[model samples]
Target: MNRQAQAVVLLLLGGAVLKASFTDLYLRYVKEGLRPFLIAAALVLVVAAVMTLWYDLRPAATAEPDEDHGHDHGHGHGTGGGHHEPRVGWLLILPVLGLLLIAPPALGSYAAGQAGTALASQQVSDYPPLPDGDPVRVAMLDYASRALFDKGQSIGDRRVVLTGFVAGGGPGGEPILARMILSCCAADGRPIKLGMAGNAPTGLAEDTWIEVTGRYSDRVAKDPVNEADIPYVTVESWREVPVPKQQYE
Candidate 1:
């Protein structure tokens, strides 16, 4: 393919990489090594396009194609055959079209209650105590995993902060619950549950986005709908926020 076509492919690849990086789907499906290559390929194509345009606009003379050499097809290069059409860099717009037309939804209620594969039992010696005086920022999964793995350990006395959506009300008409679901690997996911002890903020409902702040303490058991043995965090304060695009690491 011509340079323009190559650039277009690169742009599409790059856009896919960026989108995948932001979603749980990518982590669940894409391999690690290929992700970097896709990212780099997109950057190189973008840079080459800019440089080529600059070269054309400048007063510099253009060099003649090497007539003595046949198309370089070795070393993974493609042959530039006479029948090959000039690549239209504008075709890169396809990636933009994809972005506009296929906006992916965030991790939603569909996955909020889903559990990962079986839990891997591991040692907990590496987990440090919660910060003595201040709230500790931690991934929701780690908090839950630790709570389940080390049942006797107490964390409720310290502050912990988490972000997610407010799920619907629990049974017994208890206060509503806030949750974030993970679509991919459970290792990076695990819902951050907050038991709304106080008045839930206005406009809060099932799937309403929110951020909860509090010390990590044992709260009520997770809803029976949730099958896993994960633990819950007692929230000290809760506030609404924009829904995060991705819910996992």
Candidate 2:
């Protein structure tokens, strides 16, 4: 490929990254914390593209003549002619095509299915008392850890609210509520899940985001592991809700 083609690819890539960072489309693939870095990278790519353009557009006479032009001994290394661009450069268009034509969707049930249940952090064994509320809102991972490891001591008799996507097990199996937990970005994300008991509505589609109000049940794994069964929540009520702005915790 020529410098012009390379410049166009860079411009498209930079524009796509900048647009994704400026919009909600980026949130689907990465954590909110990565926005600034994405924007910076996009700016760098755009600047490099502009520099390429300037180099290509500057007056030819002002630029230094190719050293090979004066010495053409016909061994095919001369700048006067016979230089062939590498075909590998065309690979740059793949991402540009993906960004423009075959844009990918955010990670959802398909990804969660392949992931093991979220593990409780061993660093935190003790927790403060539950906050005051009719249905205390708790993160999915936090609730799972408390339920599985702490045996619901912190939860006590208080009701709790947890929000996540419906992963599986609504009809024949127990309903499972899950959220993606990201340490850095979606690529490193894993699913945190809690099993639901009582009257959880059935026929909910996979990846359907919802808010559930419930209390911890006695059912829990004695020795919790990544593959162990998820802890249970005796759901008191639930309702369909929009997906949160930050999809991961």
Candidate 3:
């Protein structure tokens, strides 16, 4: 790409990062803690772009005598000044265009289905009691970990709330609730799925966000792709919810 294209790419990339950082959109691609860094990095890109434009628009440097070649044929390094850049450099425009024109959804069921279930890396067999809420709001990963690892003692006799998007499961490809976990970005995202049983909503399309109030259950099923055990939730009530500001945990 020429210097003009390069500057535009830098400007566009910086603008995209600024846009994501200013809104909740960045949460879809990265963890919350990275927001400040993203802003800083974007500022740097913007500065670099401004500098490039300045240099490109400045008056041309005085042409030195073609001392080596006697005359300037300008055919490249025969006594050359021309340089070649790989055509692959143009591919950078694709991502710039994608970020500008496309508002991609957060990683949802399809991404979850493609990867193995990601649990907390730390191994903890003990868990504290659930806080005193009839249907305590529990994070999806926390519920999954406690359910599978601690044997559900922490959740004993309590209905808990889980917020996530719908994924297909159970009989006849019914909807199940799932929240994705992202360690870094969407590329590393995966889900902790809860197979819903009682009163689970039907006919929900994939990626429809929902809040489920459910009691813990002992039912478990092996993930078809990874063979990891997926725990169950005996859903008592559920309703569609707007997608959270931060889509991943």
Candidate 1 clashing pairs, residues 3+ apart or interchain: 156-216, 156-217, 158-215, 159-215, 160-214
Per-residue CA lDDT of model 2 for 83-165, tens digit only, reads: 44798988988876776666566677666767777674554659778899888899988888887777789999889999988
Among these predictions, the greatest TM-score belongs to: 2
How does each model score on lDDT? Answer: 0.53, 0.78, 0.82
Top lDDT prediction, candidate number: 3
User: Local error of candidate 2 at 105, Å?
Assistant: 2.8
lDDT of predicted model 3? 0.82
Deviating ranges (above 4 Å) for candidate 1: 1-37, 41-96, 114-126, 152-156, 169-203, 219-226, 244-247
Candidate 1 has a TM-score of: 0.52
TM-score of each: 0.52, 0.85, 0.83
Error of 2 at 4 (Å): 2.0
**Residue 137 displacement in candidate 3 (angstroms):** 0.5
Residue-level error in angstroms, candidate 2, position 12 = 0.8
Which 10-residue window in model 3 sums to the lowest lDDT? 68-77
Summarize candidate 3's per-residue lDDT along 66-146 as a digit string, tens digits. 643444565444653435467787787786777767888888888877776775354677988888878799999889889
